[model samples]
Every structure is written in structure tokens, then in C-alpha cells.
Target chain A: MSPAEHLADAGLVQLLTPAGERVDHPVYSPLAAHLDGDALRAMYRDMVLVRRFDNEATSLQRQGELGLWAQSLGQEGAQVGSGHALAPQDYVFPSYREHGVAQTRGVDLANLLRLFRGIDHGGWDPTAHNFHLYTLVIGSHTLHATGYAMGVQRDGLVGTGDPTRDTAVVTYFGDGATSQGDVNEALVFAAVNNAPLVLFCQNNQWAISEPTTRQARVPLADRGLGFGVPSVRVDGNDVIASYAVTAEALERARSGGGPTFIEAFTYRMGAHTTSDDPTRYRSAAEDEYWRQRDPIDRLRLHLEQTDELPAAFATDLEAEAVALGERIRSTVRSWGPPTPASMFDHVYASPNSVVDSERAWFESYESTFAPTQGGAR
Target chain B: MTTERITFAKAINSGLRRALEQDPKVLLMGEDIGALGGVFRVTDGLHKDFGPDRVVDTPLAESGIVGTAIGLALRGYRPVCEIQFDGFIFPAFDQITTQLAKMHYRSQGRLTLPVVIRVPFGGGIGAIEHHSESPEALFAHTPGLRVVSPSNPADAYAMIQQAIASPDPVLFFEPKVRYWDKADVDLETPAEPPHTDAAPTGLDRARVLREGTDVTLIAYGPSVAPALKAAATAAAEGTSVEVIDLRTISPLDTDTLVASVRKTGRCVVAHEAPVLYGTGAEIAARVTERCFFHLQAPVLRVGGFHVPYPVAKIEQDYLPNLDRILEAIDRTLTF
Candidate 1:
């Protein structure tokens, strides 16, 4: 199946077409109606900024500044759109590539590089942004998200009728994660417990080297239906559709409608990471196909044609994107290794005798060596 | 103080009840833990008193049970997760090791997951495969996790509460064989609140169950019983054996173990896990390293064979029984 076939699949909820036309769906179009021209422009700006950050990180990896990078190149629409749909109290459990999602939560993008730079495991405080630290292991955080939603249920934050008082949880993953036992188990748990969660799957065409077809015989959205979750497929490249679909799911969850699974049919425009090589596995024609359907460009075109794009807005966003790229480059270069003894910190929340004793022994052992010139020792 | 004689299983149940009563945040989750009271009836009656929300009968999925428990903990709820059995914990190993254990460190101490994973461990229950096994060492080897086991009803009652109250993730290994073992427990003494500024003690420390002089026989969980029996038998032959029950596996009570070994000058560590790279191997290595000068003999170990846990009919031949412990003790004493 080609990208065109998947995009035109029946039952796909899309509020905008690939050619920058504003289309409508009886269900999801109403959800996106609240987003005025300004809101849509903000979403576009977010996608542009996050894409710039991602590209800079990729360059950093190539320059040997970072160990690796997971680019959210083409999937920015799905991320920014859904991310903007989140309420302040709604927590997020993101897979490693949700940089755009992290930006939506107001997380400093520079701090995220600390992990790739090998200075820290996860540099940001999750509670500060109501966004969990990026979970690297595939499908692992899905259960955590379900569990968090279950926590929301127990806290009486669901079905409160008052929008401000209710909360929901959203977890992001790729097509590959659906095959993981944890993901399927999470679906079962969320369904049976009636957890207020949105299992957002970005079917970004490939999981590293393997294509989505290798992950599932049926549409990825259909996987959730078996678990009793209301599943939907959306054109992930359509920002308006992504936003609307996510908003609807979040509303359902907040109103105690239980878990919903949204499969965002998208494409990974870049290599899986700096460590991956798409040339060996996929065709250039396919890459070009997705690039032409670029999430940022499509939104930019729609905004321009609709007269929502003020001339200043485009120029200002371009300058902002350049500034973000520069900030990331400088911040990543300035990062240094953490203190040697700091490795022992936070292994346990409280004092542990083994850690304390080992640390003491290490300090004494290090003291045996004379200080080297220039503090090299 | 109110005291009562109860089985180790009932003691754990009572301790869980107290934790649930004291803190609404603490909830139980496991397969069959609710209506079925778990496969071993360890959690019997908790669902009735606490309701399904509090004592959740989770799907028959170990990883989901633990993974969600981590999420709940992240949300400020203290989740007491049950792993059903020792062998069953392997499915959730990735979540427990990578996520649950590392979340605090990953968050740079900004987050704490107060999750207690109750795993019924050890052999000699004469059950089917995967039902009886001791996988505590695997958890103990991982950083950011507290692995502890109770050999008696008193410790079982107190330790479960302590594990649940802890700010760090704890692998509470229940000795399945000793679940029926009866002992007096002080029910009134509240479990030391983990958030308090008191000195670190209790479940993280080892207890000198029996005091002696000639040799120190150290064990934990199911082995503690046979160790005491070995000590008593050795006492008849005039060799005073000091038996140490390692209530905590990880962050081992090196102070107590080394002190005992230094006094006795001979040591024998025992457990139901295979001796090869088992908890006993760690105890032996640590005891030898710390008490190098005080040692009168090389440290010995008594445990199951390197082979897989055998069938119930022939499990005795593979298990570390009182005779095997005594033999190791005699070897250490005579050496």
C-alpha cells in the first residue's frame, strides 16, 4: 500500500486536505471550530520551532556533540496539534521523539539535549510541566500512562462535569510499539478500568527500519477497537484534524467516556535517528512523497491562502526558528560532564548504607592518588 | 502494645490492612489479589474491606500490574503491587528494573515512586513450575530498589508496612513456604514512617535471630528457618552458632554481617536460590572482603543447585535444607 491509499482510507477523520483546503467532518470539524486564525497560526509556529530544534539536534549528533537524535521531522503536525489540545492538568507520557509535545508543555528544549549529550538521564522535572520525562523503552510508558489515568480516576478527577476540575492522560508511541506486550496490556487495562486516557499512536510509516506493514496486517487504529476503546484514524499531516481529533478524545476521557485510541497516519521524513539509515530500507520516491506532504509546509500554505498569515508573522517565525536553532547549538556545546561523585546521587530517595559505604570507599581510594596537573585527575 | 499469634501470610495481610487504613493513597494491585485473594490467598479478604478500587484484581499481566503501579506512584499514590509469584516477576522485569528503579534517579531526585511490589518467592511449597522460586537476588542487584524478605510472622507484618511506606521502590519478597509459619507479632506498633527524620533502620537492616560465638550462619527468607534449626543442632555439639536473618537483601546490612563474622571468625551463607552467583555468593564475597583478617576459615554457602528448580517430588534433593546448612557450617568450623 502506498501513502496515497493510506491517506484516502475510509473512516479517516480529517478537517483539512493535503492541498491546504479546509475540509470538514461532522464530528471532528466541530472540534476544530474553536481554533481561530490566531490559534491555528500559533500551532504552525510551534511546529516550525520544534522542527528547527530537531534539525539542530540532528546536526549536533553529526557534529559529535550529541550521542544520538530522534527527529520529529514530518510528524510535527501530529505532535504540536495534539499537544496544543492538552489542558494544564492533563499529564503526558511521551515516547522519546515527542520533542514538539515537550515544547507544548513549556519544557525548555535545551534541557532535553542534556540526555542526548550524555550529561543526565532526564534533565527536566516532569511535574513542573505535567509532562513525564521521555521514556526510551518502546511501549513501556503506555502502561504508565494508563496507570496515571487510573490514578486520575481514583483522585475523582474524571466525570466532574466542570472542565477545569477534570483531568485526562495521553501517551504517545509509534507503530512498532503496538506489537509490544506492554502496549496491548495497557489497552486491556485502560478499557477494563475505564481509565481516562488517550493512547495516541503516530504511525510514522516505519519503526526504525521496518515499515508499518511489518507491525500490523490491519490498520493500526483497528487494534484498539478489539480492546473496547473508541479508535479513530486521522490524517496526521493535517494539523487541524490532529488537533480536533485529540480534543475530542480528551473531552471523551475527561467526561468519563473511558479510553480512546487515535492512530495518526503520518510519515517519518528523516532517518529514525542519527544511528539509523533509511536509504538501506526505504525508497527515495517514498521519502520525496512524504516531504512534499510536509506537515509544516501544508499548514503554512493553508495559513497563507486563508489570509491568516500576516507578512510579519511569517518573517518573525523564520527569525525565531533561526534563534532557536542557535540557542540549541550553543547550549549543547556549552554542556559539560557532571561531577564524578554525583553519579551516586538519587540512586535512592533516602540514604542507603551500601551506596554511602561504596561512595566513602571510592573517595578514600581517589584520595590515594596525587592531584594531577590542571586538575586532570 | 497489642500482640497476637498469626501466620506469616495473615501477618502480611494485617500489615497491608493497617497501611490501607492509615493512608488512602496506598492501594493493592495484582492478578487474583482481590476476589481470589491471590493464588496463594495471601491477599484474602483485602478486596472485601477495601473495595475493588483499593484492592484491585488486575488482568493476568505482570508487566501491566507493575508498569501501571509506577504510573500511579508517579501520580502521588502509593501503589502496593503484587507480582503473584517469583517466577512471574520476570515479565515485569523491564519495568521494575528500567522504569520503577530508575525513575527517581532519572528525574534527578525530583520524583519519588513509593511502590511496593510484593513477590511471593522461595521454593519447598511443592507447587508447579514458576510457582516456587527465589528471584530476590535479581532485584537486589539492581540499584534504586530495596529487596527485603521476612522469615517470620513478626517481621512479615512489620516489613510489608515499611516497604509500602518507603519513598523508594521496594521488592518485598515473601517466603511462600513460610507463609504458614506462626509467630507472635506486635500489631499496635506503627511501621516507622518513611518520611520521618529518624535514623535508617528496620527492613533495611539484618536481624541477629540467634546469638552465638563459634560461627555465624547467615540466611534470609525460607533459609532462615533451616538456618536456626542448623544452629540449634550445632549447639548440641558445643559449637555456638550465631544465626543472622538478612531481612534486607539490597544495601545489605554489612555492619551487622561483618561484625558477626568478625566475632565468630567463620561464616556460612544460605538461601534457596542457586548458590552460583546467588545472594549467598554476594554475602560470601562481602563477608570475606570485610572480615579478611578476622576470618578463621573460608566463607561457605548452602543453596539450590545450578540447575533449574526441579519437580516437587525431587525438590528436597535440590533445596538447601537444614542438613546442607549444617554441613556447610561444619565445613567452615572444621576448616
Candidate 2:
């Protein structure tokens, strides 16, 4: 069997099928049973908006407004599912491609574009929203998330049976990150410390060009078992299953059951970034296969089948997406370059004589540049 | 102040104990640090006194130790990580340089990582290859990292506490061979008083260990002992050699170095690491830039050759000994 076929046969916890049918999974059904019609519609709306923002960002990169963009084209279900599963007090550590998750956490979409525009290193205060700055280095933030979970444990924020006060951490990474030493080490630490953490691996089948087979011999979820973290596999295209599985894992973590590894088995429908050409490394047939299982389409179909989709709701959501796209495009174009001296502003929290002197020298050097012909200093 | 003689290892232990007492959030983590008291015993008895929660015996992984320390620091904990040896630090180099060093700047001052990474460095105890290497220059070269080394028990006690207190990440390189070396420490008075009317001696300034007139011998960590020894021998021969112990390597004590060089009109930099692209090179360049007209001679450097720190049998030849330091002192005098 092909890798995809083998994965499909591996008892994937799927609540929603590809043909827009809401199927029942014996294990994950009770987790999402409390989600009423409105809640289900909200999840669908989140996935649609996230996909729209991702596409707009990609267009911005193409038009030279951004340096690069990593599109969440096909994995919106996985991101929105897990993102919505989080409590307000729960913290999140994300890899660079978590723009979808950013939306769910109430992070301003324009802030996500700041890094790609070269205007800032990271554009948000993680503590303000319980969302950390996007980590570019693969698999590194898992350790940070695990450490934060350990902190939560120490602070008596876990297993208190208080749903509002108890906290759990969710860290997002891709299939490639699972092979990194830091990610594996994080699993070891989380398990040993019984840290309140959910290791969410969005298995998008490719780590850039290399397939998941290149990195892991068995299923990636199984690797967590060796580290003593209980593992589960879910159909990432099925939004309902993704939500149910992640919610279950996070609930388990907050109640002091230790770390849980949720492998969201999905596929990357776009190039790794705008800089990549998927045609060179992957087959067109594979793209076609995943395109049929688009996360947004599956949710929309499910809503339509249940007669819950109002004509005005779909029309209004489309208009909202259009307005969001325009706002992002205009803001990105109007953003100005950072001052040259600002680079040295936060190298250290306390004053360092060396940094102070260097900043002075940089100011003097920049003063030598003449004003442009436009007379805009 | 009440003073007592103690080994450098014990001084570090005492400093850690004091830091744990002073701050409830200060944590110590590393392999074998709890039960073994560290391979070099610099953290000896700390686990026993502070308990396992504060003094953590982490799984045998350097990347995990440093990476998680970054997390603890993020959650308002000051974690001091012990990298068992200088050479074993490479396993966690990516986390150190990319994460720990860049987090503060990337956060735009929203976060402050007060994590201290203590590494036992330098060679001379006749050990294995990986155990006896010097990599201070690598960390000092990185912009965000603050690198400091203490030669004797007093500075080890004082600087460890200072590094912990600072709102920045500091790479504290402990001279392993000198762990057993003894010095006077003031146990009665804290290294840093909580509310001091007087200006405390900052960690970045260099200290002039021995005063002289003809030449300045600038060194840090293990190299300071050799430079001091060379100065004493040179003084016996009527050649007054000044010795300066460089406490901090990154934000180098250039003012102290340049002033001494201007007064003496000659300078020599000594270190255990390779001279090529080492800390000595930067010091020599900075000194030349500052004391161009005051110098009677070019700044000379005494250090190991450009090769891996050799085996125990040939370490004496590879390391900057008293003789090699004296030779550099004599070379400076010739000009």
C-alpha cells in the first residue's frame, strides 16, 4: 500500500468524512457532543476566515509586499480545531506557519505580516494573549511549551478540578519537526515531569520537500509512546475530529494525566512557502488527492447538509473576508521601514555600556547619509 | 568583613546556595548535579541543601537543559544551567545562540531571560579530549551573550551571584582545573548587598591583580594564574610586569586595559584557547585602536596553537604555561 493508504488504514479518529457526512467515532464522539449548531457554525467560520487570510498573505508575498509567506492552505481544520480547544488562560507556542492558530487566539492579522515585511522580528506580546512569538527554528518551541507546562504544574494550576483556573499548554509543529532532537527531548521532559502539555503535531506529510517516510519509519504518533507520552492519530481534514481529539488531550493534561501527543494526519496543498515550487518534488496526483479533501470545503458541505447554512451568513462571511484582505493589503503597503538605530534598542533589558556605546556609534554613522531627493527624512 | 579561605569549587557552591536563599525562583539544573554534585564538584552539596525541586538533576541532554531553562525563565524563574564540560556545550549550541541569546531582543524587551549557563572550561588536569577544551571565544563572539570567567574563589563566588541577579543571559565559564585552588572569600558580607549606598564592583570591569611599570599582562580564567606567576618571576628579574585579570570577556574591560597599556607602553594577552580568531585577537585589535600612540611595542599574545586541545600528555605544550607567558612578556620588553 501507498503511504497515504497505509495511514488511512491506521485507525484514524475521524468524525467528519470527505463527502461532507458527519460520521461518528466511538472514542471522539462524546468530546464534541456538547457543541451545538451555533458552535459548529463558528468553527466553520473560523476555518474559512483563516484560509482567506492565508491566501491574501500569499498574494501579498507574490506582489512583493512581503519577503515570503508560508501558507496554511490545506491545514486550517487542524489549526482551528486545536486553537478553539484552548482555554483563555492556556498558553500556545507555534511554529512559523501558524497564522490560522493566530486568528483563533485573537492576534491581529496585520501583526503576523510584520515579520514577513521585515518591519520587526516578532510583532506580538505573547503574554498578553497567551500566544508566544512564532519560532522559525523547527521543533525548538516544543521545549519552551513543555517548560511552561512544568511552570504551570509548579504553580498549582493543574489537576485542581477547576475548569476556569486549571491550565494546559499546546505547542504546534509539522511532520518535519518531529524528527528534531529538541522536539523529542521535549517529549522526554514533559513525560518525566508529568507536565500539563499537549504536543500537537500537524503531520502535513512533507517537511518542505522530504516526505514523512524519510523522517519516521513507523507512524510519527508511535514515536511519542517510546517517550512515555500517550499518542493518538486523527484525520486532520476532519475539523470535528481534530477539535474533539485536541480537546480531549488538553482536558487530560489540565487534569494532571501528563502529556498527550496528537498527530493530525493532513497534507500540505501548497508549496512550502512562496519560495518553493511543489511541482519539482511532489506528484500532481497527490495534490489532486488532498484537494478533494480540502478542510474548508468539508466543513461547508457538512453545514449545508444539516440545513444550518443561511444564505445571508455565507454572503456576509464572504464580504468580511474581502474587507479583511483589503485591510491587510493596505496596511502592509503603508508600513514604513524601522529606524536604523532601533535595531540596538532591546539587545539587553538592563543597560550595558557596550551596547550604549555601539548605539551612539550607529547613530553617528547613520547621520552621514544624505536625505533622499523626495525630501522625506 | 569576615574572610575565610576556600576552594574555588566550594566558593561556587556557596554562591549558588546564597542565590537560592536570596531568590525563591532561582533553579539549578544539569546532569548528575543532584547526586554526583557535578563531575567537577563545583555544584557540590547544593542539591542536598536546596532539595531536588530547585537543584534539578535533569535527563542527560544538554539541549533539553538549556532549552527548558529558557522556558523556566519565561515563566519568571531564574534558571542556572550547568553544561558538564566546555566541549559538551556544542550539543546545545543552537539553543544557546539562537534561542537563549536572541529571545530578549526578539521580544522587544517584553521578556528578560535571567538564565546563567555555567560551563567548566580550559585544560591542564590531564583529562580526555572532549573534557579539556576551551570554547569561550565562540560564545563571546555572539552579540547577545555575556561571557565572564573568574580565576579565583572570590570572583567565582561574587560573579556567579551577579550573573544570576542580572536581567540577562550570562555564559559563566568556570576554570575546572582551578576548582581546587584556594582563595579568601568574605562569607559574613554578601557578595552583593541588597541595599548598598556604595557603588558595587560591576562584573564587566577588569581587576589589576599585580601592579607594575614596564609591561601589562592581560589574562582571564585559567590564564590569569600563569600571567600572575609570570609577572612575579619577571619582577624578581627587575622587569616590572603588571597583571590584569579580565573578569568579563564579552563586554571587555577595554578602559582598564587601555589605561594600563598607556601607562606601561606595552601589552601581552594570554589565554588557553587558540590565538587565531580568539578573544586575544579582539583584545589586541581594541587595544591597538585605543592606545595607538601610547604603545612602545605591538600587543603580543600568548595562547595555544590553532589545533584541537590535544590529549592529556601534550596539554602542557598546548596550554599557555608560566614560561610561555613569560616569553611573551620578554618579547614585549624587547621593543
**Candidates, DockQ:** 0.79, 0.61
- Over B260-285, each residue of candidate 1 has an lDDT whose tens digit, in order, gives 99999999999999888888899889
- Supply the TM-score for candidate 1: 0.98
Worst 10 residues of 1 chain B by lDDT: B192-201
Steric clash pairs (candidate 2): none
Residue pairs of candidate 1 with colliding backbone atoms: none
**Alpha-carbon RMSD, each predicted model:** 1.7, 1.8
Best by DockQ: 1
lDDT of 2 by residue, B78-194 (tens): 999999989999989999999999998988889789999999999999998799888999999887888999999998998899889878899999999899999899976766531
Off by over 4 Å in 1: A1-10, A370-376, B193-201
* CA-lDDT, candidates in order: 0.91, 0.89
lDDT of 2 by residue, A1-377 (tens): 35665355377899889989978877899998887778878888888888888889999999999999999999999998888888999999999988878988999988999999998898999898899999999999999898888878878899999999999999999999988999999999999999999999999998899988778878889989999899999999888899999999999999999999999999889999999998998899889989999988998898899988899999999998899889988999999888778889888776666788889987787677786643224
Cα error of candidate 2 at position B90, Å: 0.5
Q: List TM-score (chain A only) for every prediction.
A: 0.97, 0.97
Model 1 chain A is weakest, by summed lDDT over 10 consecutive residues, at A1-10
**Per-chain TM-score, chain A, candidate 2:** 0.97
